[model samples]
Target chain A: MPLPAKAFQRWLHGIAPDTSMADVCRLSQVKRTTLAQQLVRGKVAEATVVSISRAFNVSPVTSLAYFEVYRDLAGPLVPPTRQELVSQIATVDLLRAVIARTAPEEGGGGAEESTARPAESWELSPVPHATSVKNWVDAIDDGELRHRVSAATGIAPQNYSAQLTANRLAPEVAIATSRAAGVGLAGGLVATGLITEAEAGWAAGARRAALDGLSDGELTALAGDRLQTLGKALRRQEHDQEQTEKIWENLG
Target chain B: MIEILQWTTLVACAAATLSRIPNLVRKKNRSLFYIFALMTVATLLSIKAPYLAIDGMLGNTNVANLLLRFIIFGAIYFLGMRIAKGFGDVHGLQFIRGRAGTVVLGLISLALLILFALMDSEGSSVGMMDVYAKDERNRLLVEYYGAAGRAYPAYVCLAILPAMLRAAGSTLPAMLRISALLLAVGGIAITLSLLFPVIPPALGYLTFIINYTAILCFVFGLMLIWLAKAMARRKVPEHIRKPAGT
Candidate 1:
């Protein structure tokens, strides 16, 4: 939902008490004219809010909660499921761990300790597509959960599949899936990289704890599966690019 | 029936042209403005009443027909160049800009002018076929001239049809995809009409339907693209449009 002008102004004042509008625009990486237009319209856009939140190093969900529209989604949440926790690991981090497992130790390797230990906080970045929507859905799916969520949300199977492939879940679909799985309602949002775990009330190091808790065999299998999917995705992208190139070559 | 179809298509073309008046006034995409304006005028001149009036002013020697031909040529040339570049089709752009394409267009235009000059020009008519039907020599020249007029557009359309069809089925925005589909179908219809002589004579009525529908579809397709772009400039995403008063 659009943030109200007054609420936005209040949030801006709180975030940067002495900062000028030009500074705000620069910090948010939003154009001055665009910000002015939104202010004049009496509602700021959601992306602008996210940009401002990122600029100030605050969780987007927490920033959004300052507006009345997102207040309910910001605060505390129930503990996340094991699947939800694992889903929070950034894709590159997961891949890095997999690669690190095989790499020769520099001096008297601590490979065993490395495999058993939790990830460092810096390695747990939450970029979009870190875990695809499909993976998150699958993580929560206890066989019948997907069918139940589909029925409850009234999202067609094909449409759901398309959304999964696109790596996006509509907010409603995300909420419904989380509800069906009986996990924290914010799990879907967190897993999808739409909101941070801090804002969702997940304890610090929870994701690392879950990753460390996994058996070496489970971790290897998961990494292998992800790598296979990544390979297939890269191939598909190559094919599409080739097709586009051919069209340009022959027709342009 | 043909007259009704022609009028309907003409009106659609005019509407498409008029829809871009705001863009023209704002000095946005002036090339597109000229292209649509030229196309609209060409469509208007295709009508009997306007053609007769304009032709009368031009000495009633069928100079208006030649003017209409040249306007259509200019419009199509600009359109082909713009669309090829817009689609980022380097090959299509190169072909149109390269010597081969330029020579083909030049030859066709020259052939059309020479054929028109050779034909009987005592009276004005909407079509060369209609006025020169009685003059055996002029009839042949008119046919060649018409064929020459159709050649360049068909060639360009053939080159762009594949890209347009692919775009129609792509993941582009809904309006753009629809526009691509309409434009592709219009291009196909136009190509078919241009090749009508090779088709069975019994399908003459089909040709008329395709011809008029193609004009309407092509113009409306361009209009939709313009409308979509204009709307996109001002549009706030659905999630961002909550009531401000609240």
Candidate 2:
């Protein structure tokens, strides 16, 4: 399932039905003038590549690979068929179902953790305990949890723990954690080849919601498939920009 | 005054430079590590004079040189790739190879060249050796760029453009990116103030306040990351790094 270049673009384009380049530009660190020149030239040249490279904290080689992936809509190579996309969707759904079932929260096992609570905290790696950090945080409704997390992850804003306590987990915090753990989870199921950018986006959105302090319903609202996919693209753009800035800092 | 900091910085530089090579040379998908290697070298080179002489050491010039050569160039490289995707939603630029074909690359080179020229300019130079010699805290770049429009590229690259990107979207994710970018810009401003000094910067007191605050946070973050990695590698005694894990 090696992602062909076209599939990558299709997937990139596919995230959030009709994601605009303007959105990407807003998310990326590349200057508007530089972006203009590239548009006029019709291809990312050395300058763009270098800019992207510096921007993302990656080398030109990696940037070029991404360039090929993102180069226009037609895709540099054969893309997945419609059926393939559908199948990917179906697979994701199946996993979600299994996750829901095991977690005891989604469909059948609602309120399974109503009577239970961890003594302090524990990170479960192997168990399918039918509960998510979001659910746990939501149920507990405490900022101490955010403090605990901050103590663990080294992010800030004093009341993050309080927000977790207050059932007000910040969206950004959720997204960051989700990115860290969600990608790992998805990698377990779908190989990079079989997964389209859209699916990846969804997983990211889901994870962001989980970390974000939003209730499941709220997450679902924000992450309705198309919007979630778009969010993913925007997130990727943001990540790219952060990476670019880091690259520049290193250079500076 | 700077002797202790200089030596400490040099040692850290040497350690960073040496720690990265094995990973860099390894043939198996060596990118993240390679970037680190080059970055260390660049940092070391930029700060090399600090290790040797207090007086003749590269001050603000090195910082500007590194920014144009490293940071700005890297941004252009990746932006090129994304723009290559020809679509209506974006500018839909075609991808071209070679230095001559890439206008952005041309501009970056030109910027660096101009920066070097600026470095040689009368105001850009070391006009007050005595003042710096007295305290070494009086940096020049900050004094210059902090003014209305001196560090034009730095502002655009470091501050204004990122702000615009942030404005284009109002998502929480955008907020985080904007925050990080803002802090980085602040970092640049402080570093400029410290190393590549401008004669008169914008609210030196304010700049000092923000710079130190942001930098302390950055350093603390770095320390924590290092500590976490050390603990993961069992370099940190289990008893101290993670009492809970026990």
Candidate 3:
């Protein structure tokens, strides 16, 4: 059987127990009357949807999915399948992960990388096993994890905790946490069955394309040891190619 | 009406000076502190109080003119340096701060002063206020000084203003965005005043007014920036305040 048509409403209530419908309207900067009417008619404006999502500390995609379910209920009233719900939620999670990685801190500083182990040394580290999001959350110190997630995603600490307890991973938060903990995104997401290998490959390619777009000056301006590692690697590759060419000439 | 405008300009200069003191005391930004200090001195020199006494001491050889011009040049140079620093151009800052750069700037100021003195006829004492009423030679000297004064700051503004505006347009803090906007307006105003001198006899009375308005705009714009920094400092918690050079 398909999930109930009221699944979106139920999810909203579960995640944001302290937040009222009026509070959501107020925080979203929309009129309470307008929102009420929209909810009644099973229709929400796009901008209003974004505001409501932000107000409840939920991802915009997830909020839109919830609203879509409501909008669809006004028609044939066929509930969403389990797989469909999972896909919608997983997309929201992934978006949140990307946002957490990219968002600048209060002073316009980039998100701080973990100082415990350098990113370049990850190859030498032991490979981590894929864990379910709920199990991962349970294993870690909840307070520190919440703070990191909040810093990354701009989601409230309470909402972050509630989402984790409910066995949902805001993709950005999950990806960022996994990255910091030295578990790769693909490993975590694949283990959870949240993303297929094809989707993971596409994501990796997109990231590479984005990095390739940066100008030489911008690449140089990037702070930390990442630049040093990249410079060393480039030089080593050049040196190896030169040695190989000399050997080929000697053979000829 | 002229007297009122003169007094208003003086008031603005005084306000700009007072507004800068807190930032100077905090020592938050060295370039900004120097910009305000030089501006205050420039305003005082403009009114012919200290310069009149100095000129008399020097046998009215117009040495005070050289001194005043040097201070104005210093103000413009510092303003350029501050903008360069804001744009995160470390090399630009190094160029301005280097010994070689300082020597070049000093030489340029000396050359300009000598050229102005040579251009002016013997014993001519045409105040900046009376530039329009003066003869062609004195008017040319004033025009040269105006052009030279505006050139450095204008170049700096042209190079960095777009970058600053882009930064401001992004998701930066509100105070930073406002400060960038104020600085742009001030830079544009200074450029305009230089480009359009009060040359026509009918508008001769406006020479001092226009100059002072430009000065006020530049100083007030910097003052707003100082205010923004002060606000940011207050927002930072006391416990996190680190010692200097840490």
Candidate 4:
């Protein structure tokens, strides 16, 4: 869509709300140079617009229409309601729970060589799906699949998969993966329509652990809701990333 | 199983023939390396086949089996040096570095191959004409040799991986290094499994799975490399922006 005026104001106002223009830029899935050019030219791919809008929680149309968001104009929003706060706190607590299992104890020691040689010790953990996940993550990291991830997440058309697959979308790929995956976003951010299944699963697992005390009904309902939300966010992020990649491809 | 062997033979011939195509079409020495690489890969490809296990059905040893066995051992040495040089050169290798480096590498690679070959030798069909001499000691010796058979590659990788990583410019190289590391570890695990084989052989079979661990390491390592490549392309920009953002 041609960048709309209301979309622009909403986009401008979107990012400045939480953090700054710089943060918005940082959060943008597109490279900084490309984003800057998009600002200068008043043109950006739909995917970049999606990412930029999502980053600042702006309306996508406004994000495309407007050039930038400044932090000074942003204001503090109210805290979440009680129910929302409880879910978020539980999610954070879930993340913290993982630390107990992986980290070393005081004085820094782990099991030394046992009677058995530590042969292929890495695989002893035997995660059935880790192989596939690791492979996907690796492929994605290769930057050969950013747009692919976007497409898979349903953010853009499958045809758009080529932009990232061709190795064109460079710079802040971590952000692309993180944003596209919605690695750190709360359940709400996950709900925004741009998170991948793998990412959502990880979030769900972490969230589940933290909210361990929740009733079965609450947990089940929350899981379904969170999963749905995460799927949407992953799709959105993928689409945004796809758009940013297109901008780069056109420039290239 | 026979199909796999046949497929392998077809691939080997194809690879050997394909190896020549590069040298023939371009009419360049560069093709010589490609030929060697394709041939080497073909050889590596063959070493991984079990029929090339002999001494037993697809298990019976043949000329191709013996040929592949020797070729694989010999080629591992040539393959490492060649592949190392290939990767090194593409990433801007200067000299052979030194004659000493070649000698040292050749020795190490040769030793490992020889070690693996020697271990394989334990499976020899050669029986003493004087049957009385072959006793329990013979049996024990065979068992011990079998125990350490798979461990050799694991140890070799462990020894070499750090050095390889140090020489690499990118995560991909380091990851290749990790593959070597996994080979060492995986082999050791397999060896351990063989040596202390659980009585039922069920647990023992589980240990054989260690060989695949090297494959897993390579899999994950490959992922890291892709990430690094992607990151490296943008690293300069990321560096530039990090300070400003901070």
Provide backbone clash counts, one per model: 4, 59, 5, 20
Where is model 4 chain B poorest over a 10-residue stretch in terms of lDDT?
A: B237-246
List model 2 lDDT by residue over B23-140, tens digit each. Answer: 4565422333343344344334334353223223445433433342454234323322221221111221332233333654455456545544443322222223323333323434
Native-vs-model 2 lDDT?
A: 0.36
Candidate 4 accuracy as TM-score? 0.31
TM-score of chain B of 3: 0.70
DockQ agreement of candidate 3 with the native complex? 0.00
Q: What lDDT tens digits, residue by residue, belong to model 4 across residues A53-81? A: 66655554333324432121122222222
Instruction: Give the runs in model 2 whose Cα sits over 4 Å from its true position.
Output: A1-252, B28-246
Every model's Cα RMSD, please? 11.1, 26.2, 17.5, 22.0
Task: Report model 1's interface C-alpha RMSD after superposition on the true interface residues.
Answer: 11.7
Q: Write the per-residue lDDT of candidate 2 for residues A1-252, one digit (tens) a residue.
A: 122334334434533246465555554566767666655655443334434344334443333334433222222222222222222232133233334444543354343223223442222122111122233333232434444556555777455544433323333344333233322222211211222233223332332223223345633443354244435645765764554334232321
Model 4 misses residue A29 by how many Å? 17
User: lDDT of candidate 1 vs native?
Assistant: 0.73
Cα displacement (angstroms), candidate 1, residue A213, comes to: 5.0
Number of the predicted model whose TM-score against the real structure is largest: 1
What's the i-RMS for candidate 4 in angstroms?
Answer: 15.2
**DockQ of each candidate relative to the true complex:** 0.05, 0.02, 0.00, 0.01
